[model samples]
Target: MDTILNLGLNDQTVQVLAEATGNERFALDCYRRFIQMYGDIVLNVEFNKFEDALERNKRRFRVEYDHELQPEHLKKIIDEYKEIIKSSTGSEFPQEPMEQLRKAVMAVFESWNNPRAQVYRRVNKIPDDLGTGVNIQTMVFGNTGDNSGTGVAFTRDPATGENVIFGEYLINAQGEDVVAGIRTPLPISKLQEEMPEAYDQFQKTCTLLEKHYRDLQDIEFTIEQGKLYLLQTRSGKRTAAAAVKIAVDMVKESLISKEEAILRVDPDQLNQVLHKRLDTKVKFNVLAKGLPASPGAASGYVVFDANEAERCGQNGDKVILVRMETTPDDIHGLVMAQGVLTSRGGMTSHAAVVARGMGKPCVCGCEALNIDYKAKKMTVGDSEIKQGDLITMDGGTGQVILGKVPVISPEMSEELQLLLQWSDEIRRLGVFTNADAPADAKRAREFGA
Candidate 1:
């Protein structure tokens, strides 16, 4: 399935896409690209056919990049793409802008039942009948030039909930280039060095968004020739530790009332804070290092296939699911696994996102681990670990160890104590625990039980 973006468009729909490059040229180019994309996605025309035509044109024009294609080249490609669509789908490409818009809108509605979407909805427990809605708005071009780019940012550190801007961006790239992990994007802070003016504007916008929403905001933005444009903003998803810290800090800052802050923390998330952690004092052989996609420590027999992971889990054997990259189809295995390890995917990829939501330990984008699915084995440097081999991982540190390692019980920090105290004060429901032993009761009491 194609990567879909839900953009909020106001009255100036055409103006936004055209603003960066000037006049109707950029807008017209966008429309042509849209027609090709829509034909392949909605009209069931093969994408390769359109891509081949584009590549052919690029070769003919002696252009090294798609963006280097001139207006005439783009027009020729669009015409060829349309012909391919007509031949393949037996339908004419909608030339009228309104007709194309209508079809695109309907295509979004139809995508709800696509295999990937269906799998995601089922795994996430989203109701199937709740059809997707279309939001037609102005398009913004992030791939106009070096000064133009797209990025995603968090008001606070997503991994630790630190009060800092955290995100990644790519110069002269679209939103999909970042989110799809097609390219390894530069750190958001790099924007400060590369485009200081745009970075300052973005910082101001982030501050505004957090203040207005009274929560850590995850924002998507585009810069057109050093001009900053906010695409969208929503409450950012953070780790359990960050969630607690953010809630308590927000209350102290008076951004939100105590009761609101108390309600912000999820009861289920508290379990995430209590998960096992590797003992830093104890040394162990580290197989590889990757991004700390989720927090916790887990040890299990390695399983390359998701279905095998599920089978092992159902049989009461702990398993860690390893993959090149995960999709919605791997959700069942992810649910059953003690942890997830992926070789190729960013922190926001499907594996990372799902593992975080499930409070499962995950290490992603581990480029050091070369996985061979057919052999059901993975090699990290000189060591080759086969299926069912015992392995341990520290998600907090993004360490993949050769064997089970020593771990310690996680202790509640001062921040957690303060947050829980505030929650206990304002929450209507009384907190209770079934700790039967003295030590268990003592720990519960310490956690504000």
Candidate 2:
């Protein structure tokens, strides 16, 4: 889903918004976000150019995150952003609201055929002829102040299938900032201390949504001036292990029938639950360590860019996609890579979330390694790893190994075994398998063939 927030803001409306809200800082922040998004998505300006400008301002003001910048600092950023747009696009940031809206809508439609979208559709087996739709609505400001924020949440843990509210949020930030992994976000539990009213309302809303849908829900929410708003809700995406645990748990809770639970789990995703793990007995050199964003082990040649990852994969190479951080546009590379590594971003970063959804191994926030894309190398002190160097990563441990390490197959979780038993009991078709050897036959029998 492509989103462009603060759509109505222009030179005139910015001042109007500031006066109406009595918060010039919030208005200026909105304008800055609009330009960055508009310049990147609509006007085709490089997003990093805007990030570079923002980073300069952040350094100048000695602030770490975007929300820490003052109104005067934001004003400077806005001016510089406009100049960047003008210089890059050979035109000023469009001042006319209607024209901007039209172009924005068109951009969304055109994004249907973007590289990332195409890759996603191909990976998910979605038909290419299916197009995308555009939704236009009034923009609510989440960057208004400390009382406002945005977040993404799941009614149950997407990674673990634990029956807990799991998510992350950023105070005084737009929705994209949370998902884009540009800034690390705080856990949803922290919201209770930060904005108790909004947090309470959100919990109730999550409960209602889960009960009504009869499944775990993924929710997008925003708070403006301490008031809660539900942006949207759908069935949450979860790992294979989580899917089995949730379905079994729902059946136990009487929220769903055993048959329904069996239907809920995708047979293909079961492979993720049976994924390989690093051989604990093997000795290996640790190149770096990071946050264990997902659970599995994989080894592949290191590739720095998404496009290169895809090309290498197409040419029959196993690659680990390394990045400062991933965005929605990196779907192609994420799909292609055996695993993912990032020097920036946290556990709920876009790369981690997407990797877990795809049942891929991922290690995030590995700061010990410095990645130089232009140089096609990664460095740790004096040790250098060039592109195509063989590397192994254990997403369960967040360890990046110097070279390939052997992996052992994992046993099925108890929940997964129980789910499989239920599936066999309910399924009508008789299962059989062809075995060329005694070992094959024994294994097939063990699997209930």
Candidate 3:
């Protein structure tokens, strides 16, 4: 089985969209991607055949496949892809959207068995048969014009647990592009500068999701012709610090009871917060800045990017991973590094989320820093530091400082005591904080009533 993103277009759905856009191209394109996905997924059509055809089609169009391909170009590929699908499978791409949709759903269900997905489940201890729900949504265009864009935003900072909405957006781009790291995504702050009205409305939506869900919400949305359509929303995962902070703060805001707040912080994530991080006060010569997706302090010899970070680490050298922006490919670098830094993406970006999941130190979205990997040096406006010169990144403060500074792992806050007490009283569980170091447990107990 394969994971599938179903295009739930029916005759009416297709007709309406075709009528609305006055262009059948867009609907046809969606229809084609769905059929290709379904046939490969449900029918088990040989992927190499499609892959070979796609490569030839891309070459014929003289356009990049997937990466940085303009929406117009993608539309052209869609038409060509439709031809290729019919040629390979001897069937026209399914015109019946709902049948197209059902097959897609089954494909998604089957994706659970894909080797990659199975490995993921094994690592995470997820059962194999429990399937992913298919979200058959109305296609909301984010590539309509200048008034359109797509983004994924969190109700609060998952890295530091701050109340600020943290996210990335791609103006005039669509969903998967934002995640694929095809083109560097702009920070949400860019939306404020470029599209103020949309940004404001976006904030309101974030607030609504948080308020209604009563927890941090991660939302995916698109603006089409200056109107926002929410594609999906779910309770967000947060860093240990942010989890604690948001939980406590929510109690102060009267959003949830103290017990609920205590329950919100996962013990595993709490262990992550307890790790010693790079201190923020030291001076940094400066390197290229990317999106500050994750938070924590770290220092190591500069490895140009994820690949070097991994190679150096496997060879037993402490290395810091630097990149313009990290994608799914950077997982190895993140795994092998003492820390991570990026020049693009936001707090909700893939690098940030994955880094947090691994409990690795990461600082992203630092536009002020620049790294010249070829020279093995990082520079700010006036200062430059060599690759192996040693520098530090502060995840909590969003700073890249010079050398390793002394880290102070403080005891837990007094407020935590009250919060956890409430949780223990309510849930009737022991509610112990998972702490690697003694200081963490002391801090946990410090919050006792």
Candidate 4:
């Protein structure tokens, strides 16, 4: 539903939708929704206008459910939505369906120049003129009924890198409901109890996806009236520790060659493995827990503003940057901070991706922490932490602790050493290095050079 609405559709997609649902009306409904959504998101038509129209129709029909509206009422909504668009833009909505499709395509092209897109491209070093690809796919309705649902899952635990499925899902809801934080979603495990057959099928699908892709997969799926449909799948992101463990395990499982395993782990991500870590055996006062977006540990004074974080960092004071959510504009502060904490955002959000790329410790989607930027403070339960107040965090466990906490330097694991050894054995080229000092030579010898 999201893809068709956002990207517009081609004949192929329409045909698939017709075939899947065996309802011509389903395709027509998709077109109607696409027009309204595209107009609101890309054509600058205020969404409230369309929303108000929908609410009015619901009331007039005496229907509490969106899907409960009669076909005629939905048709009325489409007409009303078009009128709203026409009035807001001082232009008539395209009467021809092909013209509407063309306009939507152009709007997607225009989005490349939008401020948010430009900032993301610049920050990520993506070429500005390369343009984004449009993928028009058949829609699957997760909000069909009690037997319908949507979810996102990882073949492995994203937080700890364990080779166990990790994800969240919402029943009788769209995909956006889970990611947008509109409501707290149930853990993926709950699905096993609620829908055992679907859960088993999903587990098999996960294994197949990972095996076919030759990597851990992040997958989105929808169950429509008890039928499972895979929406999308891609390689999953992980912290440096998790990356190392996964690569090593994959090699051991004979799923990939040692050379492939070695190549899989990013060299830059290794820096994250060297960061300080909280001792698991140590006791501390726990404030809250959230998604462990990046792995490491740090204790620092909190600062809400990015500019302030930069300023404090420049003065040699360790600081943790806190925000409701972060953008590419916060890059400077992210670079300066010892760690990062956010009240909102998931494992793949801007803050998480950036912090992991920079090898910084980060805890995101900490919903328990209510931040007030103007007040320069954040609260968890009855406790309030003001600006410049010291706190410690373990990005590996996603634990926020009050005040300073002792940490120890991370040591290279035996598994990592074995993986490197296997890599050396598999590669054609011999391992060699130039050592300028006795200390360097000693370290090289220790590494079995």
Worst-scoring 10-residue span by lDDT in model 1: 2-11
TM-score, prediction 1: 0.77
lDDT at 292 for candidate 3? 51
- Compose the digit string of candidate 2's lDDT tens values, residues 1-449: 57788997899999999999999988898899999999999998999999989999999999998888899999999999999999987888999999999999999999898888887888778998987799887777688888899899999988789999998888888888877777777889999999998899899999999989999898988899899988889898787888999999999999999999988988789768877889989888788999888878999999999999989999989999999899988888888899999987777788888898899999988888898989999998788999999999988899999889999987667888788799888789999999999988986786778
CA-lDDT, candidates in order: 0.78, 0.89, 0.68, 0.77
lDDT of 4: 0.77
Model 4 bad stretches (over 4 Å):
1-40, 44-100, 113-130, 279-284, 300-338, 344-358, 373-376, 386-390, 403-406, 423-449
Per residue, candidate 1 scores C-alpha lDDT tens digits across 210-239 of 999999998888887788888889887777
In the range 315-338, model 4's lDDT, one tens digit per residue, is 999999998778655777887899
Q: Which is the winner by lDDT between candidate 2 and candidate 4?
A: 2
Ordered list by lDDT, greatest first: 2, 1, 4, 3
Worst 10 residues of 4 by lDDT: 1-10
- Candidate 3 TM-score over all chains jointly: 0.67
Q: Best candidate per lDDT, number?
A: 2
Which residue ranges in model 2 land beyond 4 Å of their true spot? 433-443
Report how far residue 137 has shifted in candidate 2, in Å. Answer: 2.6
